[model samples]
Target chain A: MPSPRYTRDIPARYRLDAARCSACGHVALPRRTICSGCRSQDMEPVRLTRRGTVVTSTVIHVPPDEFTTEAPYAMAIIETPEGARLMAQVVDCQAEEVVPGMELSLEFRRIRREGHGGILCYGHKGVPVRRHEA
Target chain B: MRDVAIVGAGMTRFGELWDASLRDLFVEAALAGLGSAGADRVDSIYVGNMAAGQFVGQEHLGPLMADHLGMHGVPAVRIESACASGGAALRMGFLDIASGQSDLVLVAGVEKMTDGADVTNVLATASDQETEVYHGITFPGLYAMIARLRMERGTTTEEDLHWIAVKNHRHGAMNPKAQFRREISVDDVARSTMVAEPLRMLHCSPVSDGAAAVLLAPLDQARRYTDRPVRIAGSGMATSTIALADRPDPADLDVVRLSAERAYAMAGMSPERVQLAEVHDCFTVAEVCCLEALHLANGSEASQAARTGYSALGGRVPVNTSGGLKSKGHPVGATGVAQVIELFDQLRGEAGERQVPDAHVGLAQNMGGSGASSVVHILERV
Candidate 1:
């Protein structure tokens, strides 16, 4: 990935910043000028919640070049209470343990290194929400 | 617009063709198509190639392929829509003839995937780089998520999925041009190494290097080229969200449904009228989804089509009779053109062993990037 492209997505990756369309209330992550739902340009910047529920997931055993070291990791589509969805890696648990309906909190973490001498890329990863023991 | 017909079709045997360069594959397929049509030259050419720049470090394919095929000075262009590039190019050729702009047009799709480039990374470029690919999601990973959702919804089962590979491999055994030309049982598919959960290595289409080409002409002039010409009845293309997660229902594949609806509407036919089809089965789950989306089967019937032999040869609506992307080979851009070749062969009674009896109408559905884009074409034996 190019450095400029990575830098442009920092706000969404780091803070879950999204844009909500005033016309149809559709929230677009990483923001967009035009609305996908209603094609309206009336949009407002909003911060998405850090927590979401897993909509679907897959454990990637054969990964791409950048994520080879993180093989056997779970990546999932997480839906937030705001009705927005984003894809993120589900970490801090076994890959097989991440399932649909599981609750997770997105946390800022180092995603991967572009190459041997490339800069470190950081993004949000899903951490399983644990319950308090009585 | 005037009606268009495919007067000729040809393709290179799909596999790891380390001996063939990108230009060699295109020229070979182009010559075969021209020879089959008995035409000394074409008025224009359209090349369907996904990533020649990334795979072979070459671009400007329009002129490059035209010059190599000895058709320089003719109008030539390349069309791309990820994996659906072939179908998109065919559509362009169809329009060119239908609009009276060209009399004879050649459409070819080629990909040299064995060229030492990182195939996975090159393919990943089709997806949303910042959103999806940045997270390390391979194409298998995307389809695996869809498979999981389908399994959870009872739309398909692991066993049902394996039946697809089994059926395609069985059909591929009869196709001399297929890459994997041997039969396999459901057990064989189940025992294969798992690439992504619910999708084994057998369930995925292999990365391949090959090319396919077709010659198109106005329906009125088609007889001058061939005695038996397959009429291109309808062509439709549609798109959806690039990122799979953006869809309301990832398994629905609305792009396929929309494109098929347009094609069926234009053809003045319904899904039932399609006697045979070559659907994009990049993954086993994809075939299941495409069946339902194309309206060839509904609900669980899509999953059960293979198990009950309904989708196999000699069934109600034989599908993937030329193997499929699963067993035949998916050289990205070449897949759509290859699908047309299969339909053309079957319609003309040229497909020796896996021919669909009395096949009059056929459909080809090609999709790209986890169903983000789709192209549907309906053909009739004219």
Candidate 2:
């Protein structure tokens, strides 16, 4: 998942845009052209729910060069209520604190910088839902 | 399809061979395999490589290696499936002989991983760039998530993972060609530096530079190359979505299961019948998952087999007797071909101390990128 020039999916990557299958109602993240669960080509655009729960999480100690400063950070696979899963870094929490079943809310954040003094790449990351509760 | 048999096997000592170029490694393994076969009737060549372009800034390895091996004018091609490139190439070579397209074929797997570059980034390119790897996750972090999920299920324990490293290192100690040819206890694994929490350095395969090669011939004429030949009874390969998140289940690898089923069906044998195996152990967690997917163990209980020493060498089913990709060193593309080399040595009774007694039928399962794709082959001594 190192930084690459994926300019096409900017909308989906930034806004958490997804494709909702017209036939089977299966939702795919990052806006799929066709439904993954169903063989249906008919799809509709939808904004994914920012709120989700951590399905799985890990503390990345030895990270990539782009994330050297963020070593020993928490990353997780957050599953939304609509049944779409996306990987996002867990901010506003300790690495060990982000465990399975923890409530989270997706927030737009700076993911990393690509190339030398390249463009500032921004995407969705998971923040503990407790901040919103307060 | 006609019967296909492997008449020769060879590979370079897997490690950080700083002096060896990608071409040097391939030629060493290819010539050793040809020497083992004792013939030069190879009509075609297939090279399995993952990322020659990224790792060593080289590409078009097919013609390059074929010409380097003195296999001039023969048809040459490259097969790639991330880490499973080596295994996938073997499957392609098997088909070449089975389809009667080539009388003899050379299949080789090679990778140059230690060029003083950031290999972690090069390997991560195999994962989903936009979705997963973009989240600042390395390869270890990906598998660590799998291990975390399995641990939450209470079916797999940290000790279960440690057992895999312990058993593989024990086997690796006897393998002179292995990268880590020294044994270590469970504590050694526990104390090793954590690359990703719950996945330590000892639990991960090392960055290596090496190559492996095998020669395939029709079963009817295999004896012309070597008195002993291993038959490629079955080969199966399957692919899933590239992103692990796209997969229906992170708890298990369905690609491995589906591919192994096709292989078992072709071979007409069950997992119990096989005397030994070399499942892809890219991570310690991967081996346990593969055991169940290969039907060597049942469900998540595969970790139980590891804990009980049932998967150890000379146990219920010896897995990774050549130390696997873990202790043996994973040069990525060369791994699949290297696995068959282990089976060749074991089945022919050439494996000295690590030989599984009376080993006959063996299975080698190679997977790519968090089990998105898998290639399974069943080989038997004939």
Candidate 3:
């Protein structure tokens, strides 16, 4: 991964910022040139709500090189209230227990280190909101 | 536009292949295709490789393969659409002939995945680096999410997923060149190690290294190469947002539906007209999902279709007779061309043990990066 390209995506990953199509109210996370809902190019930045629900979840036993140490972790496609879905790891819970419809709160966390000499990458992970209350 | 036909098809045995380098595997398959066609040379070549740079530290495969295959000066190019590289290359080759641009074109797909690199990280290059991959998800984890969603909907059962593996392995056992050429039981699949929840090791395709090749020519001139040529009746391709989240539904696989619709329309045929199919079953769930999208199955309840033997060898529509990617060994870039080879064998009455009876029309659907890209080709006996 090139440093400049990696650096450019920092804000989107770190803060869950998205591009909302002005014409159609379609929110595209991490930004987009075309709106998926209406195919409009006019867009503006919008910060996503931290709250969401896991529509589906999986326990990753085999992971990428940087995430090898975190094998067997739970990952999910959590959809926010704004209708934007994103892939994130579900933290602080058993992998099997993470299920559809589970509430989540996105939090910033370390994702990985590129390679031996690469920079450390960080992104948002879904922490089950219900788990804390229980 | 002129009609195009595949005059010859060939592939290497699907496996780890410790002895063959990337270039060697490609040349071997290309030579076999040329030999099968009984032609001394081709006018041009297209090489399909997902990541030669990442997998083998070699890029510019088009010239490398063209040079290795002794076709030094002709137009050669590389095409990539992640896992769909092979199919996408074939699509371009089809267009090359259909548009009267080039008559003799050889398309080859190859991937050398066992090069001691981190397989998971290398495969992750296909995913959305800014959103999905950035959050630390592998292909298995991604597909597993698709499977988990289906399981929750009551449309698919765990048993349905297991049967796909069992069925493909049985088909693979009869194939001499398959990677895992042995049948496995439902219990075996159930007891296998879990890579992701609801998806065991058996449910997944192996990290394989192999190559497959196909030769294309104008349909009118196909007789010059072989008496039994497989006609490229139709071709369709579509792309979705790279981020899986951008799609309407993660479970729908809309791009697959769109591509299949286009191919079927271009062929002027319906799903019922297809006697056999070679689907991109990189995972068990993908087979069922794609079946629904292709309209081979009446509904999204593909679990019912699998359980009732709708996709069996002797059923309404035989699928994955080549053992699919699960058993056939998906070399990433080689899968599309390999699929066309299976269609060629079946249509020519050459597929011995796992042949679909009286097969005339066949469809091959190859997809890339979790439905980010999909290519569909419909073939028939010419």
| Top TM-score prediction, candidate number | 1
**Over the stretch B1-382, how does candidate 2's per-residue lDDT look in tens digits?**
9999999988999999999999999999999999998976589999999999998888988789878877678899899999999999999999999999998999999999998768998999899988888789889998999999999889799988998999888888889999999988889999999988779998899999999999999999999999999999899999888877777678689999999999999999887888899999999999999998898888656897666878887688889999998899999999999999999999999999888898889999999998888999999999
Candidate 1, B57-91: lDDT as tens digits: 99889999989988799999999999999999999
Question: Which ten-residue region of model 1 chain B has the weakest summed lDDT?
Answer: B147-156
Best of the two (2, 3) by lDDT: 2
Better candidate number, 1 or 3, judged by TM-score: 1
Interface RMSD measured for model 2: 0.8
Name model 2 segments beyond 4 Å from true.
Answer: A1-6, A131-134
| lDDT of predicted model 3 | 0.89
What fraction of the true interface contacts does model 1 reproduce?
0.73
Ranking by TM-score: 1, 2, 3
Per-residue lDDT over A40-120 for candidate 2, one digit per residue giving the tens place of the 0 to 100 score? 999899889888999998899899999999888999988998888898899987889999999998999999887787778
C-alpha positional error of residue B382 in candidate 1 after TM-score superposition, expressed in Å: 1.0
Tell me the TM-score that candidate 3 gets on chain A alone.
0.92
Q: Every model's DockQ, to 2 decimals?
A: 0.84, 0.85, 0.82
Best by DockQ: 2
Q: Which number leads on lDDT?
A: 1
